[model samples]
Target: MWERQDFVLLLDLDAFAPKDRVDAFHLALNDTSVPNDVVHESPEKGIRARFETWRVGSLDLFDVRSTGFEVRRTARHVRRHRERPVVSVSLQTMGVHRAENAGERYVLGPDDIAIFHELTPRLYGWSGEAASWAVTIDMEDLGVPVDTVTRASVRLRTSPVHDLVLAHLRTLRRDPGGLEKDPGAAALGTATTDLVRALLTSAAHDAEDRRVRAVMNDSLTQRIMAYTRCHLTDPELSPDRIAHAHAISRRRLYAVLGRAGIRLEQWVISERLEAACRLLTSPRHAGLPVSAVAARCGFTSPSHFTRRFRAAYGVTPREWRRHRIQESSRTPPDGPPDTIPPTA
Candidate 1:
């Protein structure tokens, strides 16, 4: 059913008979889609929706699931889409989604986000109620240059920013009221949309192939970044070890780090410094010595890390730790976590 006021198409297919189900809602979108394709047979029960809103940034949303058909939306695998002229940033809010873009396939699930040029041949399919949430945004409006958008969209590893956007989208879904009203809704919408491009450029991590190298490198960098966070105290951590474990070359490691806006050694040092700051700030780790904490986070020389830490954070590691402890003692829970609603 299409909601005129909201410009939203809501599809609920749980009630359709198995064969009837496939026949009814398997219709592909035609307005700006690549074509001459149809669903041969539908899978079992699933839900899907696609909608658009022409507000700031031309917000568009697509939600769908239909037994994971390779249903077409393009003329061919290589042909560019002349119709859907916008680049889309998609967030997997629930269940799962599999998309083929840039000649490589991505398996994404709830909370994971990806960006792709929609004008190119792209395919999205799902099964088992594989749900997703998305917002289609135009390229030119993204503030960053097309080259920057192109660079960032495929190179950067997913960041805290992506999680923040996912949180906002899911929160709005659970509470659509705040945005349906006046300036408040508009304000929130603007803020939410602004982050979309940031996430794209950041995820693109400055890669153009946008296929295996871009995403794989980004994912590797994230895992490496995370591992560094968890083991900041271990000085043994280095690019060689990371590359060996991930089965990539040292050049590839540095390239991945480059996408994160820092090279390998610099990145490791910086991440350790950040973790040290976090540890110092938390009351739990506040009692630990600055040097010990530094060592634990892979920082060798206390003075060197301290100088860099102060430069990066505008305060010494110890000072940041103290400030954090003080802040946490008074900081209340900001709000409920934006969580996925089971079996909507």
Candidate 2:
């Protein structure tokens, strides 16, 4: 039987008759998403399983606890779910979980996280009493290319962000009710997306196959831009630090960005200048001095900041602020004000 409470859904085999448990479980899973073949290790002893699911924004979270069972998704199943692809990140909480996908076998113990794609054929099972929590994210929402995901799937632990992401997932597992009731669940979902992107980007960079790495360089360029934007206020942010952070050589980093036509230092300078412009026009920072705004946006010197700001926006910071203020007074109360365009 399936139970629904608000946004959460639960299916407990105990609620079903002994003869109907397996079929009910299969049907429930098939109804939710893709189809899979489920086989209990000891049907005579009866199946004891519970599945609970809830949504955190665009990500769907699942908690599955069972005695022992095997679930297999064949090529036929992949074909059925081809149009709607998803990546699942599963964290084993109790007992051992084993998976075979893409001609590779993976074993995960308690606290281990495994990432797999639903578009691929897979075999997953547990031998004894096992419990796991997983989150399903649409590949489109995940923002990583499928090839990069497939390559990073096997090298997740290599990323420096892996442990941080693992901790975050653990926290999500700890508070289902709080997540459901929280108004900021959407923001948390966005943060999860960013963390997962960072993890996969870093992991994919560690791949040994140079051909695959080269193929993923374009995705890596985007990750680098995102990482740089987040660390714009850090004075220590540099190509060496960025390269080390992503576990790639500095030369490789330059080459990747070069192929993408992104001048690293110039891009960083433009981003900082853009940030300064936003602060200059912001009402909250209305009282902040031009030099203070520059410092806050990662410019080391006031004169250097002024030169770059004028070069990028054709106006000094003070002039930009004065112009915005004047424009704001003339605009209708409900109308949108013009924004400074980003530097190229």
TM-score of every candidate relative to the true structure: 0.46, 0.59
Off by over 4 Å in 2: 1-7, 207-344
lDDT (C-alpha) at residue 4 in model 1: 15
lDDT of 1 at 291: 89
lDDT of 2 by residue, 132-214 (tens): 88998888887778767777787788876677677778766755544655686886677677677777777888556564355
Q: Kindly report the root-mean-square deviation of model 1 from the true structure over all alpha carbons.
A: 12.4
Best candidate according to TM-score: 2
CA lDDT of each prediction against the hidden true structure? 0.54, 0.77
| TM-score of model number 2 | 0.59
Top-lDDT structure, candidate number: 2
Scored by Cα lDDT, where does model 1 land? 0.54
